[model samples]
Target: MQLTNKAGTPVQWQDYLKSGHRIFIGSNAAVPNALIDNLIENSAQLHDIETVHILTFSDNVWAKPEHKDLFKVNTLFIGGKNVREAVAEGRADYTPCFISEIPTLFKQNILPLDAALVMVSPPDEYGYCSLGVSVDVVASAVKSAKVVIAQVNPHMPCTNGHSFIHVNQIHAWLTAEQRLPEIPDQQIDPVSERIGQYAAMLVENGATIQIGIGKIPSAVLKYLMNHKDLGVHSEMISDGIIDLMKSGVINNRRKTFHKGKTVTTFCIGTQRLYDFVDKNQHVEFYPSEHVNSPVNIAKNDNMVSINSAIEVDLTGQVVSDSIGHQFYSGIGGQVDFVRGAWLSKGGKPVIVLPSTTKDGCISRIVPHITEGGGVVTSRGHVGYVVTEFGIANLIGKSIRERALELIRIAHPKFRDDLLQQVRKHYWVPTYQDNTPTSVPELGAVELKKFTLGGERFILRPLSPADERRLQEFFYSHTKETLMMRYNHHLTQMTRENSCQLVSVDQHKDLALCFTQRDHLGEIIQAVGRYYFIEASNSAEVAFVIRETQRSKGMATTLLLQMIKIAKKRKLSSLIACVRRDNAAMLKVFENAGFVRGYSEDFDEISLCLTLEETITNAKEIE
Candidate 1:
């Protein structure tokens, strides 16, 4: 409950927690093991213990699946590290927030903390040492932790930045020489290297770089060796950053936060990098909220955010998490950093990916997304998208141009098919399918499921535009129905015109009877009213909203009541020239026990039903 330091060399604490407030320790490679060991010794005395971190690789006691009775995790960004698994397994928890906001949340008492376990270098003669180059977000916590416990070590670097606080600020100090963990650098592909170049090209000098974990990001960093005074403020870093820092390319000179020092949420690089950060005041690690906040990232000058995606549609919708319906990864800091980069002065938000998948059967650049594909980055947020083939700047392109531009950058093998997909979706009339061969053009309405409602009322075209639907509907009708309801002799009518009979309410008494909810607790069981422009109550279809349209059952709710009025009035037996293929409407009348009869005057078929029969069908569903 107090921020007072222990006031002794190699300070120590006998009681870490004295109240409901839990001390939050940074996890991942930056975990303060000295403090953690002390915590274990006193773990039995603690209640409602909570710790927040992206991931950790220690004894795993803090968030072990078996110890849910004690520790809890409030993770920021997910990593392959232990803490992430503990959360997904339910031993811990996932609290989503941008990395940049963690420090504020800590300071504003949004996530109140009673203490903090930090690691740092031993103080110099002047009682000062660096928080190291990784000053990304830990500085905020250092300023706010009620009890600042530092793990002072000589191996830790003394890099310049706002990371260092005087020994007087720390309540307890746990001296140790434990080093930060290292994440190795793997090889990069030629195409990934090219894409990295393009992504890096957009980055101006003195820009803050936020890159994720991958060969692409590493490759992009490779191109920036010649760029001067680039700053680093990101979630994690590998060997790629070590060379830059040693080369004077990353001096952290232009950064707004932790100026003159490297800033990072955590580090996972090589043994060399690990040895370099051991008590080396140059490296610092903090929670993701401080590192990934949009506001925090925007503080740097000329911020450049480079992120990767699975696929990007012509409209610039970036899908980075899924293959289709499967969940590949969670929505992480791409959006956070992208927004931050966009808001920074002279910032550039870029999405970099290969033009096609590994197999090359499918193009990474599509005209539109697959069914149920999630849009991780919206069209408006996208600035630059680059693939091996070319760079697409969809920032201001029209929908049509976007599609063509994406297709142009698509692998040659799949470009034609994607263009055809464009024609099918947007319904751009007179669309050319880019390919020489004629591919049957499909409509934009993706995968239509046969809703039970389709049986009751047809989407009969109201005009020539409806002819296509009529042709499709009638083609599925029975021969007997074709001859009875529609034939060459009848008007060359389509489904659109067939539903144009009349209003169901021809009688005054029965007009309002069926509008009420049926026995099934549904209101649209039947409707009766004057239907067509002619008010032809003489013929009516006693329609019901089918089961398929249950929640969205807007159709039958109106038709059911309409049928009641038509039956109440002795209106010409309620004529109907339904297509023989119209099964839904047929079910309505058939279930109601209404029989079909041919019209001699119009040479068309119709149905006649009594008031009793209309009530019977409406009641059956109820």
Candidate 2:
């Protein structure tokens, strides 16, 4: 068959073919396999022919040893399973570039393409063809390549937005029918489910979110099913988003930028997902230059970017693209969205991974990154790291604090060794506690959110990693409050002293704090704790509230929670010593059924609540 250009002149495929030509291929599921197979069939006519592309789901026959002499393969993103061995074996080349900047490489002739092989939807009535599900960098390749060969497929979804290419631009075309490649869904494991639960908690209602592919991302989407008005501005979307969109959870109505539209560069999922976006007006596809641009992403308020990592060092450096010197995957849009989310208003850049590898023999959290491993997300760019163990907020943390926070969320079996390593490195003081505490069940230690004075706050158990936060809380307290709470004019609370307060065994002695989050990080607004008195068959309780946060009934709330905990422990009684002048605290205790008693210290009065009697009275009242 003879193909013709817009000028109506018959075009021959051999006329554009040359021995040393560099060719660009469409990325992901949009690869034009028919054109590629034809090129391979004519390999005898070509030598030193370089082929460039990003990730592709099709069989990478060009990278095979038999075709190595004829075609030199170079990939922008190293994610194809069949091509990874070739790149690792040094037979194929991997170029590291951000998805957002890939277009510039083509536009400026940096990677200079002689021809582009692409698959597109059949031309519409206006003679314009849509780039379908993979418009990311293919749009630039089509415009910059000298010779454009297209495999027009009827199965390609004719998506909306900046995905159209006029048929006149094509030098030649051939009709083909093929199913787009699909990414099979993997089952969500327990570890991934836990990480997802924690990551989902960081997302708020009516917020924009960017998530990538994999078990952890799917788990996050699973837990977000109940969220309202969620928006998506991601580089790609998978089948995980279909249920959320159908349930009206991801309406994109509250998005600050590109409101009412789900923005993406490409997609790779099942036929169901393709059918969902085929003629869907709510879904819009744009070039990676615009979709992954940090400035464009930051335009949306409350942007939450959740990405996975291969390994993370204690100091917050993330290794994603490679494990040591071996290239695993290409530098995709992780940094782009992370920086974008960091710049957005009320944004959260979250990294979620399992605490250990699949075998559970190696910890993903390490004292340092594996030698030669590239740091894709620098320590400064990292905000939150989540594992099945827990979430660690590392923004604005010191090296010592970062170490402690990361160690706390690491696998328990490796915590002591990690602590020793950090101690040797002087990341933590020598006197820092080395005993690893048992991880609490999620149901028992889940964070409780409450609002006071029109501001939100969280109440949860104090962790050993909270030593610095506890110190900050001490410094935030007024001198009068210190005297009233501790009965001493304490001038300073050293790290050593703060460590003792935060590292107690919760089963024996309980410590809890109320924290309010701001631009700086979580700030402690109130602290309530009780020391178990075994001999007395009771517990000694105390409370302190930040001066600015006082008189808002925080003390009452703390006291009530403490009472509930005490009741659960089945203690005989609860005790406290309050200064006579502290009428507010005295009322809080009294309202909770604490009876005042004479005290030897003239300035202080003793208070006690007998649990047995209180429960009986409450039951009678009920």
Index of the highest-lDDT prediction: 2
Residue range 505-587, candidate 2, lDDT tens digits: 77777787889765338888899989999998799989999999988778777777777777777888999999999999999
lDDT of 1 by residue, 56-101 (tens): 5455556666556556666554455456566556665655554556
Q: TM-score of each candidate?
A: 0.58, 0.91
Return the clash pairs for model 2, or none. Answer: none
Error in Å for residue 360 of model 2:
1.3
Q: What is the lDDT of residue 70 in candidate 2?
A: 84
**Candidate 2 to truth, TM:** 0.91
Residue-level error in angstroms, candidate 2, position 21 = 1.8
Where model 1 places Cα greater than 4 Å from the true spot, the runs are 1-14, 18-21, 55-61, 204-213, 225-238, 241-268, 271-303, 310-314, 319-333, 343-346, 355-376, 410-417, 420-424, 427-430, 435-622
